[model samples]
Target: NLKIILGHMGEGLPYSMWRIDNRNAWVKTEPNYPAKKRIADYFHSNFWLTTSGNFRTQTLVDAMLEIGSDRILFSADWPFENVDHAAEWFDTASISENDRIKIGRTNAARLFKLEA
Candidate 1:
């Protein structure tokens, strides 16, 4: 399975997934459309998201609840956004310590198969 990682909190897909899926179910796609499963199915199976420029806590928590921590990775937008701000926000985020560790470090290591 090809794995794709999206930055900027999935470019807002986490919040829009339900709507996308709902519309997909309500409307018929063109015959040329190839996807047979729900958008959330693809997200759960093949996608990962990064906490890049987006730093809102409620948004992060919403994403975590929608997609689970295993599919998230921490990222600093670097030259585009201050690393300190990202670090400060993430360090003080209200998520549980277990989830914080997973999102901040372990998830990437596990996805990349790197030695810890």
Candidate 2:
């Protein structure tokens, strides 16, 4: 399987996801998308989102609820964005400890197959 990581929560891909899914669900005409499942479904299965420099609690909560935490990775833009800021925000995000840990480190390790 090709590991795909999406930067900046796919740079508003989630909004497009909602639009695609909504359109596909409501419209009955022969759709242009040939996928077997909805766009959001594909996203859930194939894509990973990184927080990077976009660190907003509401956005994080929204994404976590919309897609999930397993595919969300913690990242710092560095030079441009401070690692300390990211860490600080992450440490206090509204998500649970388990989800926080998953997004913060475990998920990345699992995705990259890092041991220890």
Candidate 3:
């Protein structure tokens, strides 16, 4: 399966994952709904998110809680946002060092299959 990466924390989709899944469950009787699985399931299975221009720690933490650090990558939305600003914020974000390393480096490396 092709993996999809979304920038700006899936444009805020993480915040709505629970609602989407819950409503999706409620709508199980609808035959017209083409998706075979819940939205959150698709998120978990096939999606990755990037920090991009949205750099709030709370938002980042919320996304981490929703999808885990393994599915996140760091980005600056360069030209639109300052790379240094992104770096500074990310460097100080209130997450474990392991998670910080994953989001900042290893996650992208693994996702893109980069050579070490």
Full candidate order by lDDT, most accurate first:
3, 1, 2
Clashes by residue pair, model 3: none
Colliding residue pairs in candidate 2:
none
Q: Ten residues in a row with the worst lDDT in model 3? A: 24-33
Ranking 1 against 3 by lDDT, winner: 3
lDDT of 3 at 100: 95
Candidate of highest lDDT: 3
lDDT of candidate 3?
Answer: 0.91
Off by over 4 Å in 2: 27-29
lDDT of each: 0.90, 0.85, 0.91
In model 1, which regions exceed 4 Å deviation?
28-31
Greater lDDT among 2 and 3 belongs to 3
Count clashes in each candidate, considering only residues at least 3 apart in sequence or on different chains: 0, 0, 0
Q: How many backbone clashes does candidate 1 have?
A: 0
